[model samples]
Target: MSTVNDTKFSFAVFFLTGIPGQKDVHVWISIPFCLMYLISIVGNSVIVFIIKTDPSLHEPMYIFLSILAVTNLSLSISTIPIILGIYLFNSREISLDTCLAQLFSIHFLQCTESSVLLLMAFDRFIVIHDPLRYASVVTLPRIAKMGLVCVLRAVAVVVPLLFLLKRFQYGRANVLSHSCCLHQDVMKMVCSDITVNNIYGLFVKILTMGLDSLLIFLSYVMILKTVMSITSHTESIKAQNTCVSHLFAVIVFYTPEISLSVLHRFGKGSFPLIQILLGYITLLVSPVLNPIVYSMKSKHLHANIIKAFFK
Candidate 1:
């Protein structure tokens, strides 16, 4: 039972492996990763810019979406330096402090994104169940407050990881499986008892991702119930259609995340490169696709996007 107070490895350094076993193709692999990162930054930036300029998009749904875009941008930005370092420069050595900082930022952004999605779900619920009060209930101040809470909660939950990780003494090879530093990946290198790290990691996952997912599910269930009660089939379809983009966004965000989680926890037979691919997908897909999905699906946003580009 190694306690956190026993060891303090403040200055340890870890080497990052860029797609283990596929070292020969790292440069080739980096092509797509770089492309995706570029697209995500451009796409999400455009979304945020469009939302800020268009007063018409000053609604709760778009506001929450802007938060998601910002979170995706943060996630993409946080990983780029280290990932690109591994792929392009073969610079795999990262200081302990840098690794911990990256780990915290990555998870914090993930938690914030999850929280934003939950707020989006709540927005949909209000719009469906109480359309009359939608504007009043989801006001600008309230949305701003919700966004603040989301960010604050993410910070609060991830800050403890810094304390927990600092206590571990990394006596192993100190090599990470992924190009980017992840809490689970880093914890595996520690020589001391990792029971606290494991438990805390699980607790954070359940607290942030687990709880948000459950609420989002329940929201959609209620949304479906409301849609089903409509007298006209066309009306029901129309009501459900509003959620199509959000549903796609949710699927895009969670599928890769769940797959990555499964790979890390249970997919021992899976190749290391396969896990790394999933890691890339988890980081890249949502950020790249989210703004595109919203822009293609929302007529107002699409029009604004065109106007912004051509005007």
Candidate 2:
């Protein structure tokens, strides 16, 4: 048990845990993780490259997609080093500073991704609800400003978490539940009073992800209403189809997050392996799947992907 002094400074070195009870198979497990990381990097990079190089793909939707791709790439890059180190090299020890940095990066990127998704939802709604005015409403400059706001908002919300955490002394066991450091996982290791941290953390989550989700839901409802009011059934279906890829992206991003929250709150006695696996899904799956979802669903993007790769 490592201890910190009254200065609120921690010299503690935290050990990241891999899948519980799977030490012997960690090497084998790393293979699939490596593949997923590779796919995430390559897929998101291709998406970004296609969007950047093609003049036709410079619209608000594709610009937003490029931002999402960059976010996914950063998210994956932040976690891959620690995860692969743990599974492949059995390098599980992470310094307190490094752990806090990882925690900040993961949460910040998650919030930014949520904001981007909400922006995408808004984009789709505008396109469907008022196609003629979308050009004036959702211009490239406005999209750039929105993207900047998302990043700055995430920083403002998540940076305080570091200060809140820094005031604590993590004298208890420093073994984190997941290979990557999460705010909640790190919070659990603190031996000091955590009431403020808990309250503030919850507040940030609600303000950022929770609020974004509600607005996204409302946007979709309005979209549905507009689509229904359209007299042509084919047009309604076409409008609905525009959202399928984004819907998949939302599901891919949020399902694991929701599951992990439920697991942490109610499934305390659940299997440790299950907990770790869910954590991996939360961190890894969105980056791995988002590009594939868009590539398969968007005809323009799909064609470009083929041209870039196959031709």
Candidate 3:
């Protein structure tokens, strides 16, 4: 552990980071993450461009898709650049301020993306349950308002949580086990009592992750009920298909996130290598999976993707 210098410029935070066992292992890990990062950038960039350029896709769902694409782009960029930097250079040292900044941005963007997904759920519910009045209800002004609210919600919730975390006094150890600065890894550097931080972390998970997921589940429940009441078999089938892609994307997003959180809390120090490996894998998989999942499983999105590519 390094000491925090009283003089600002003299301060250098040493991170506790893991190195791949062999050169071969480093290459293997680096290769996949590199590919995922590339594909995610291209896929998400195309989605944003297509949505912006296509007049027909000016609807609520496409707008949300565009939002998700941009979020995914930023989220993955924030993570992978640092991850790749570590892998290539084996640099583990990070300043306290830099680590904290990374922690805040990582959580801020990731949680913002999750909030957007919740809004997408509501958008789907409106489209399916009341298609007749969908246009009237989801007017342009209303869409803008909803978008603003979602942004504010994510910032409002995550900003305070992160600011509160900065209150914890930290030791000089800045090395992280994983590529990027995960909250848990950074929190472990705290020299002060972390009771307040832990409590607040719990509150954030309950409100942002737990509560958001619960609401998503409820939205789908209501969506299912509404679908069932309709006697038209084809309509129900279409509704089911429309939801399947989103369901896959949601599962891909939340399952690994929750698993990583649980593993950090309970499985610390038992298998650090396994944990870091899984952390890197999850970070690579979650954002990249969305575009692939949507393209493969969603006919409408696939068509749009094809048209965009060809054009």
Best candidate, lDDT-wise?
Answer: 2
For model 2, residues 179-220, the per-residue Cα lDDT tens digits are 998887788888777888878887887898889989999999
RMSD of each: 2.8, 2.2, 2.8
lDDT of 3 by residue, 139-159 (tens): 878878877887787678667
lDDT of 1 by residue, 1-311 (tens): 35443333554779887766677888997898788889889999999999998999988888888889999999999997678888888999888888888998899998899998899888988898889999789888888788889889999989998899886677524878888888878887887898898788888888998899899999999998898788898978777877888888888877777777777767754677778778877777888899888999888899999998898
Task: Give me candidate 2's TM-score against the actual structure.
Answer: 0.95
Evaluate residue 308 in candidate 2 and report its C-alpha lDDT on the 0 to 100 scale.
Answer: 79
Error of 3 at 79 (Å): 0.9
C-alpha lDDT score of every prediction, in listed order: 0.85, 0.89, 0.76
TM-score of each: 0.93, 0.95, 0.90
Q: Total clashes, candidate 2?
A: 0
Give the CA lDDT, 0 to 100, for residue 132 in model 3.
95
Report the C-alpha displacement of residue 20, candidate 3, in angstroms. Answer: 4.9
Sorted on TM-score, best first, the list reads 2, 1, 3
Model 3 residue runs over 4 Å out of place are: 1-12, 16-20
Task: Score candidate 1 by TM-score against the native.
Answer: 0.93
Question: What lDDT does candidate 3 reach at residue 157?
Answer: 67
